[model samples]
Target: MLRPGSTTAPSTPLIAPLAAPRTARPRRPGLKAAALAGLLALPLLLPATSRAQETTAADASQPTAPAADAGGGETRTEVAEAKTAEARAAIAAAQEEDANDPLEGMNRAIFWFNEGVDTVLLRPAAKVYRTVVPDFAQTGIRNVLWNLRSPLTLANKLLQGDWDGASVATERFLINSTIGLGGLIDVAGDHGLTYEYESFDQTLAVWGVPEGFYLVLPFLGSSTLRDAVGFGVEAYGDPVSRYLSNTHDDWASYTRAGVYAVDLRAQYLDVLDDMKRNSVDYYATMRSLYRQRQNNYIRNGKVDPDQFPSIPDYDSK
Candidate 1:
């Protein structure tokens, strides 16, 4: 198949040498690149390293941790143990009453101020009220006040989708207000219908709000961020408050509040006194009790008696 004068050899693809694949050297990270990567990762690593160091320091600083054997397994000297003890003591002394309370300093200050007010004015007034008020009359006032809270409870129940609770609250309110003579008696309870009280705070808790932090409010003792917000809701939504405001009876609101505070204080006087007497640290004790009870209430769980180690003895304040 060649032309007579053609000089070109027939190209034989079959016997031709195949070109070798170019071997590529794997490019390693350069020193500068590795350094840059390390630099970038340092922030992420630093926190962990810092935490690790702190933990190690804490461990190293402890007297409880057994020292490595020195030749014949002699432990750390007594001086070392003493130093550790001193450090621990210092830490304990310096630590806040409730580490969980982020606003501990502010809370304690407010608590002291509240205590001053109570000691000066409220306590004496509450004592006088308790002394002068007839027992039956006090009971009646309590009943009426409790009854007034029905609307709040009912609304919260409805919000929480507790139809049965809302229904019960409604029946209780109607029966007590009418049959019990303006909630001065316990007709509802006598008929085996009792309260299923729920606050707007509890409703918020039911709706999956996290308790942000412990707070000791000015007059209101135990609260959290969520509870504070809930309190604002309750304040605005209070039917009695709204009614009084509409009727231009603002004085009634003040009177109602004053009576309520005095009554509550009187009721808790013995309980609080006993708590103060028995507690090594009143602030800490109150914090524990408040958090424990509130948490139980929020979850609709019965409080574990064991959780309250130092129950200085009071029922249902």
Candidate 2:
């Protein structure tokens, strides 16, 4: 009820508002204490959570560590395999070299004997010849010697079925013997008909003959069994040798052979010296070179440049 003179409103509403009855919520001391404790420990718990996350991250990266280790292991395995292959190759090369030089002891003895002869007699003679002979005279002598061997080269070319080479050799011989005045000048070479040396050994090689074992002749620096046989045939069948033999002038034939040897040696002085200077095993080096040269000859000088030794240009010098 409101008094007419009262300035204050009534404490209770005139009509109760339409609403559901409110339930009282009870206070729990234990739940309040637990919440307060959790709040108090929050700082420490945060660090522990971060530590756990770091541990999980490290565990995730662990698999990749093993992958890296496996990669390293593979690299090591490859290196080991490469080393093994190299060792095997070295052993195989050694065995092959040994097989090629079966008569090493005897060959070395003969090689030393040849070396001795070269050192004592041939080398000095070659030096003297080079000093005394003019370059033009040397060229003339070389031409003459090559011309003398033209017939033999032609025969070998024919035997090897090289018709073109035989024809060139015949033309060179005819031109040089007459126009060049017994081959004192290379008129055929001036006309672009270059001389090509051929041997019975090369012919035999073309015919599929094996070179046989490496041999060191008493006078010859290096040879094979096949080449030694070829040399004997050449000596017996040489036109000049035959003519001299028939004329009963054995001394003249010897003189010719001696001069040929000296001239050949003189031409290769620098080349041989370079080889001897650089070689670890002179005999083995010579053997390898001889085989390479013989192979080159058999192939008619058609070989890889890398496979050939550094032979000096006699004409250029």
Candidate 3:
């Protein structure tokens, strides 16, 4: 084969001129001259034929070279295009999934209701707490009082299963909350602590009240259908209810409701804010969170924030 840049071969074939007309006399001399001429011209002519042969041979050896390379390039291009299309489709699906959450409307309703209750009833009560109490010191005392009351209720609840322990704990809670605080208000006793804690809530559980279906009550926070009613009844039995009636004695109903609203608001502020931010379905979010809390309570008899997702916050830290 010829090298890529070379235009000519080394041997060039020569052409012979026509021999002098064959004559009868002295034809040998003429033949010899013709042979000599043919020999001399053969070099130039041979080179041309050799080059043509080399070109033909090279062409014959690689008939499919260009076609094979072209086909491979096309295949590579098609694969790249397909991969790009697939990636775009995946991104579109993800965006669509994010856009279509089902619980948005319910969540909005709950959010607005909670906001209204907070503004109208709860904030004012907190202000009263601020005014009556001595700075940071009173809040700590109030917290302790609140905590002492919780154990009594918790013991009362546990006692339905282990009645004896409930009886003992109730006595402890009553003695501590009422006498310990010096007759101002036996808050724990108002909830129905006899010598021990006793209440309709504990009574119902003792009588085997099945926990009804869980329901989200927007401003009121989490409760089962049955427990919600239980809460209402229990609220009337509160020590503060008696205090408001006997001491303040004027618009006692309104004052008691305001206090209840304040306490409720303070308890749920962090978790409620979280649901507003993280959940697309506000009702479902609340339901799920409440259920989760209940399950933990059943298991360990306490609320642990670790089990729940963090509520949304401005800083989100």
Candidate 4:
């Protein structure tokens, strides 16, 4: 299972204004080449993954059948194959839509560059942060922040007429913030309140958006246009952004960026393969998924269960 620190919060509690402008992190001379090399080498590590896939295909080709049903089974297999082909075609059509959109291509480039910067620099720092800080404390800090912001999410849901979602958001926020301690100002079990958290992605679904447009962003991955915009808007409203702007401390900004990157990386890792597997056109898949999620969030303040794409069956599995 993916660890909690990842997606522990809906959005980065730290806002964009608290950090430097969204530009590529400048790399040292020759570092770019090294980053490129690392990117290229990533696929090389998947030889065993590929071999396993081959074995699975071979096994699948030699299907087992009950002795009495051989002829009928052949027909069934053909029908199944046809359905699989149709599914593949549908996925491809979705991908084509994403590819045709000019914005997605640009997003993809940005996503990779961001990934390179994070993998090389930010991720290492995050590992250290985790080591130096108590895990429980950090997670607690994150949850506290999320609680404080839940009201804003609640209001948005209410405006959208998603009363059920607004109620749930309000309840979770109140329970977590009060018990989580005024979110730092109230503690949970101590106050005798308990609630489960929802994901940022899920929140988008409640808002009503499209899904299946796949985008590989430089720092972000596999996002739709709606999600990208939502991230930006959320950043604008974050308290951390307000705090950092008032303080004007460069170090504070950097610290916030580091934490934000770590949180984002962890969340994306969970659904990375699902995005790739569900659509032949990575761009369209992201767009579709993101759009669907946003529409869901707007209309009901929650993603419909069926809208979440399943992770493709991994041959290695």
lDDT of 1: 0.80
lDDT (10s digit) by residue, model 4, range 37-122: 99998988899899999999997888566743888888888877877787677666655553445565577677668657866886
Clashing pairs in 2: none
| Candidate 3 local lDDT, residue 16 | 36
Evaluate all candidate structures by whole-model CA lDDT and list the values in order.
Answer: 0.80, 0.86, 0.59, 0.60
Question: What is the TM-score of candidate 3?
Answer: 0.43
Superior candidate under lDDT, 3 versus 4 = 4
Best model number under TM-score:
2
Instruction: Check candidate 1 and list the clashing pairs.
Output: none
lDDT of 1 by residue, 153-207 (tens): 8899899999988899999999999999999998999998887657878898888
Ordered by lDDT, highest first, the candidates read: 2, 1, 4, 3
Kindly list the per-residue Cα lDDT of model 2 for residues 1-317, writing each as its tens digit: 67899988778656555583445334567988999999999998999999999999999977778789999999988877776677677666664754477888999999999999999999999999999999999999999989988989999999999999999999999999999999999999999999887999988888999888888888877888899999999999988889999999999889888999999999999999999999999887888778877878888788755443333222311
Off by over 4 Å in 2: 1-48, 55-57, 60-67, 70-91, 94-99, 304-317
Model 1: worst 10 consecutive residues (lDDT sum): 308-317
Q: For each predicted model, how many residue pairs clash, with residues at least 3 apart or on different chains?
A: 0, 0, 22, 59
Best by lDDT: 2
TM-score of each: 0.65, 0.76, 0.43, 0.48
Model 2, residue 193: C-alpha shift (Å)? 0.8
